[model samples]
Target: MPETALLPDSAAPAAGPEALDDTHYRQSFGALCEDQVVSATNAIYAENGTKLIEKGSRIDRELYARLVQHKLRDPIDQQIGIEGMVNHESLEAMAAALLDQATVPRLLAASLGRPAALLQPLRELPLPGPIALKLTLMRDRCPALLQHALATLLVAMFLADRANMPTPLRSHLAAAALLRDIGMLHMDPAWLAADRRLNAQERRHLHAHPITSVLLIRQQGGYAPEVAAAVFEHHERLDGSGYPRGLRAERISPMGRILLLAELVAALGHKFGEASPHRLGLVLRLNHRALPGALIAQLLPALQGDVLASKVQVEEASQRFAGVANAFEQWTELQQDMKPGEVRGEAFAWLNSRLAGLRQSLTEAGGPPEQPSFLLAHAAGDDLHVADALALGREALWQLGSICGHALQRWPALADAERDHAAGDAAVARWCAWTGAMLAGLPGSSVD
Candidate 1:
C-alpha cells in the first residue's frame, strides 16, 4: 500500500472547461512536433532494450515457471500484448491472424476513410520500435513479444491523455510514463527469472529503470530537460509508496501520476482470479475517464477482436461480386480486374433474386415480406453457397453504418506471450503504429 497523504489541496481543474476546438487541436499538434524526442519504436528500443527468441518457437516453460517466482506472482498478466503489460482492451484481435486485424488491412481502411482512429493504438508518434538499435533482445526471454507489450503500455498512456488535460501536461505525461520501465530490459534474464524474488539489493537495481530511461533520452541529445525531469520523478508517487523518491501528489508530476496509474493497472491487471483482464479493462476505461487513477489499467479480456464473423461476412460479401461460395476465389486467380462493374452488377442481381423469392414466399404465407434474414448454413446444391452469402452479408452490414467489431467482449487467454516481447524493439514497434492507424481509420500517421 502507498503512504497516506498528510497535506492536501482538494481542488483540481474543472471537468468541463470548454474544450479546445479542431483549430486548437492543431496548436497542440504543432507543439508536440516541436518537441525533439527521437520518439518512435526504433528510438525507444535503441534507448532501452527487449528480449529476442527464435521465431515460431514457444518459450521455455521451465524458464517461465522459474521467472514467475513467489514475489513476482503478485502480478498476474493474462491477455497481455506483445510486451508484458496489459492495455486498453486486448488488441490481440486487432493484430491477430484470426481477424486480419494487423497493420495492412487497417492501412487500407484508413485510406478508405472507413472509421475514426479514436480508441485505436497509434494515438501519437515518436514512439519506440522493434529492431535492435544499441542492443539485442535475443539474449533475454521473449524479446519481440515483450516489446509489443511495452508499446501497448505506451499506447495506453497516449489514449489516457484524452481526458480534458493540457497539451504540455499530456505530452509530459506520455513521455515519462512510456519510458518509466526502460531499465528493466537490461537486467540479467537470470535475475528477471529469479525464483526467490528480489532482495533489497535487487530492489535498488530495479529502481534504476526510470533513471536509465532519463539518461538515455539525454544521451540521445534532444528531448527537453523538463521531459527528462518528469521521467526521473515518475517513481516518486503522491502517497509516498514509490521508490527512489517518496514525493507526494504535489511533487509528483502529472506524468508521474499517469505512469503510476499505468504501473498499478499493469501490475494489478496481470493478476489471476477475481481481477480478470476483461473486468480490469472495463473498470480502467471507466475510471481513467472519470477520475484518471494514479495507476493505469488496460485489461485484456475486455478486448474485442476483429469485428465478428457476421460483420466479416458483410465485408467479404460487399467486396465480392458473386452471391456465394468461391465466387471471389476465381477472381483472386485472375490478375486483371473484371470488366467495369460486372462483379457488382452480378452480385446485386443475385441479391435481388433472393429478395424477390423471399417477398413471394412471405406473400404466399399472407405475411409481411421484407429482406431475408438468413444464417450462414451450407445446403448442398444450393443456388448460393454459404461463403458467398456471408460475403454479401458483410457488405450489407457495412451499408448499414455498422463496422465489423461493433459488439465485442474481452479474451483472457490471448496475451500470455506478450511479456516475452521487448520494449523498443523495431518490429513490434512498427506493428503497434500500423495497428493504431488501422483501428482509428486514419492515414499518413505512425505511432512511433
Candidate 2:
C-alpha cells in the first residue's frame, strides 16, 4: 500500500476566481503538462479530510509538484475524479471513443461499439458508482492502462453473459476487470517501456504487480470480496504454470477463470488483428488442459467463425508436434548426461555452422513468431508435405543442439556448467515447443 504524506500547500495568486469551465473534465494528479493551471472540482482533502487546496484556488507548478511528490495511493487518488469527462452514453461508447485510433479486431471493435447483447445480461447488476468513473479517469491518467482495462472488461462481460451468470456475480467480474491492474501504477515506468525482455528480478517485479493491485483494493475497501480474489488470481493458470500462487484447474475460482480469459483475449486483440481468435484458439490448444475447457468452449463462439474441423485437425497436428518436441527434449537430456569436459573444438564449430544454416532456413520459411499459413494445419488446405515435416523436425533438433552446445561453450568450467546446462535444457524445450507450433501453424504456449 502507498503511504500518504502531508506537504504545505503553495501560495495562491491574489487574482480572484479565474474563469472555470465545468464542461471541461478535471485532470488527475501528474496530469499537469507544463503551464496548465489546476482547478479543483471537488474540495481537496487529505486522507484525514484536512483541507489542502482551496476549491477555487489556482494550482501552479510548485504546488502540482508538491502534491505529486507527497502523493500516496489514498489521499491523492481519492481526491481526483475524471469520471463523466468523456460524457459518453454507455461504457461501450466510451471504450469505442477511447480506442478509435487503435487497430483492434473487427469483432472486438464491434463488441465495444454496440455491446447491447453483452451488456443486457449485466444490466441488472449493481456496479459500484465509481467503477466506470475510476476507469474513465484512469484513461486520462494512463491511456494504455485504460485500453487494457476496457478490453478486459469487454471480454469479461461477454464471457459472463455466455455463462449466464447472475447480475451480482457479473458485477464482481466487471469491477475486477477495471481495477485488477491498478497496482501497475507503482511499477517502474521504464520497465514497462523497455523493448527487450525483462531479466529475472525485473520479471519478479512484473509478477508482483497483481498482488500489489490486490493489496491496494483491499486497503481501499468497497470492492466485493470476489473482485479482490479475482484480481489476485488473474495471473494464475489452471495448469499451475502461472506465478504468484500456481493454483491449477479446480483450485482457480470461476471469476478468476473469466479474468484469465479476458486478459488473453485483450492481448490477442492488441497483437493480431482479424486473426485474434484463430491465434487465441491456437494458444488454448497449445496449452492443452492448462486452461479450463469450459471457458474455451464459451469463448470459441465469440471468435467470429467456427472452424471446428480445422480446429480438430490443428489439435491432431499438435499431437504430432508434441512427438517431435519430445525428440528434442530427450536429446537435451542425453547431452546433459554426458561427462563434464570441453567439447571438441572442431565439433563445436561444426555445430555452430549447422545451427546458423538451420536458423537461416527458419527465417526464409518465415518461422517462429510467424505461424504456418493455414493455422499451419495440413488438413486446413495447407500444402505441407512429408519433406516439409522432415525439415521442420530437423530444424527442431538443430535448435536443441545449438542451445545445448552454446551453454557448454559459454560455461566450459565445471563451476558454471550445472547452471548453464539447466538454462540450456529449459531453452531447448521452449524452442522445440515454439518450433513445432510454428510448423503446425498453432499458437505456442509461451504466447501467455
Candidate 3:
C-alpha cells in the first residue's frame, strides 16, 4: 500500500470547509452533467462561485449519475445577443468541447475503464483550461465563475508582461490556463481514493500524470507553442531537479518560464483558506527558482491576488498589480539578454520596436555599454549561494561610497567583514585599492 492513499487505520483529521484547488481531477462527461444539476439546484451559490460541488454525497457514483440525468438539457439554438446566434446550443457545444479535453478524459476513461465517447468536436475549437474552467463556473455557478474568469485574466496580464507576450494573446492565456492539468484526468478511480490513504501504484501514477499531460497536449496541438512548452515544463526545476524532463535553465522557453507563475498562484491559492504558512514559500519559490527573474517578478503581485482572491475587498484587484509586475519583469529580462559587447547600431535598431517604451540602458551614447547593476551583482555575487557575496558586496559598496565622499560617517560591522572600520573613512581608500587589485588579480587583500 502507498502512504498517500492510505494509512494503517489511523484517525482522520476533522473536515471543515473544503476548497478544491486541484483541477488535475475533472468530471467525467456524465459527472459534468450531474455537477451542473446539483450546482443549478443550489442556484444562488452555483453561479456566484463557479461550478462548485457541495461537500456531501458527491463521491457517490450512482447519485452522480442520477443528478446529471436530471440536470441535462438539450441544446436549444437561440439568439444570445444582437446576432441572436448565441444560445443553449452554442453553450452546450462549448461545454462538450471543454469536457472532451484529451488529457482529462483519457485519465478518466482509464480510471473508469470505459471507452471514451464520440468526442471529436472537442478537438475542433479547443478552449484553454482557464477558459474551460470559467465556462464550467458560469454553467454551474455564476459568481464563482466570474471570480475565476477575473483571476485568470489578471494572472495572464502579469504573465504576459513577464513573458513579453502581448495582450492580444489572450487565447494563449486561455489555452495554458485550461489545459494545465489534462493529463491527470485519466487516472484510475482508485487514484483519487481521497478517503484516507494511497496505495503504491496510485503514487506512481500521480507522479507520471504531469508528463503524460504534456504528451496529450502535443497530440491535440491544443495549445499555443509556448503555452504547451510551459505546460510541459511548469513542473521543471531551476537546478535541473524537477520532473518529466529535468531540463536546465537555458532550455526552458520564455512561455514555460512565465507559466510557472500561474501554476504557483493556482496551486497554492487554496492553501490560503487553511492559513498555511507555506503559501508564502510556494509564491516565492515559483519565481525564485530557475524561472526568469524578469517575468517572474511581475507575476508576484498577481500571484498575491490569487492567494488573496477569497479574502480581498478590492474590485478587480488583479489588474493593477499585474501592470506593475509586468513592467519591471520585462525590464529585468531585457538587461539580462543584452549582449555584453555588441554593437549599438544593429542590436538597438532591431530590438527598439520591441522595447514597449520601457526604460533600459542597453548601450551608451557612444556604443555598447557596461552591464546593468542587477546583472553585475550576479556576476560578482554567487547568485543562488549568495549569502557571503551579498554581505561582502554591501560592505564593499559602503566602504567605496565613504571614499567617494558619499557615505555616512559611522558604519556598522557586517558579518562578512574581515576587518573593523577601525581605520574610519580611510578604510574606504584601502577598500578601493583592494578592489582594484582583486579586479586586476594582482594579490594582497582578498574579497571573500
Query: Best by lDDT, which number?
Result: 2
Report the lDDT tens digits of candidate 3 across residue range 1-448.
Answer: 1322211122122211122212223344344434443222222122234433443322333544443333223110010011122233454354343224322222222333322221222233355333343344344423332232233333443455445565445445545544555555555544543243443345545555555555555544445565556666666656454555667787665556555555544333422333222233333432254455665455444323222212321211222222223333543454455556533343233223223221221221111112223323343323321322222222232222222221111122211256543222233334333433332342111121
Candidate with top TM-score is 2
Using TM-score as the measure, what is the rank order of every candidate, best first?
2, 3, 1
Position 364, candidate 2: lDDT: 46
| TM-score of model number 1 | 0.35
User: How big is the RMSD of model 1?
Assistant: 24.2
State each model's CA lDDT, in order: 0.35, 0.53, 0.37
lDDT (10s digit) by residue, model 2, range 1-448: 1111100012111211121111112334344323343455456766555677766556654565666444332444344433244333455565555345433324543544555654443344334433444454456566777678767877787778768788778877877887888766656556666254454456666777776666656556676678777887788877565656667777667888999878877866676554455555554544445567777776655564522222234444444445444544444454565457534344334433444543344444434312433224444444333323333433344344334433334333312324543433433434433443444453332222
Name the 10 consecutive residues with the lowest summed lDDT in model 3: 74-83
User: Candidate 1 residues 223-341, lDDT tens each?
Assistant: 44555666666555454435555466667655455555555444433331122333334334323322244334322222322222221333333222222112222222231333443
> What is the TM-score of candidate 3?
0.37
Report clash pairs, candidate 2: none
Cα error of candidate 3 at position 292, Å: 3.4
lDDT score of residue 206 within candidate 2 = 73
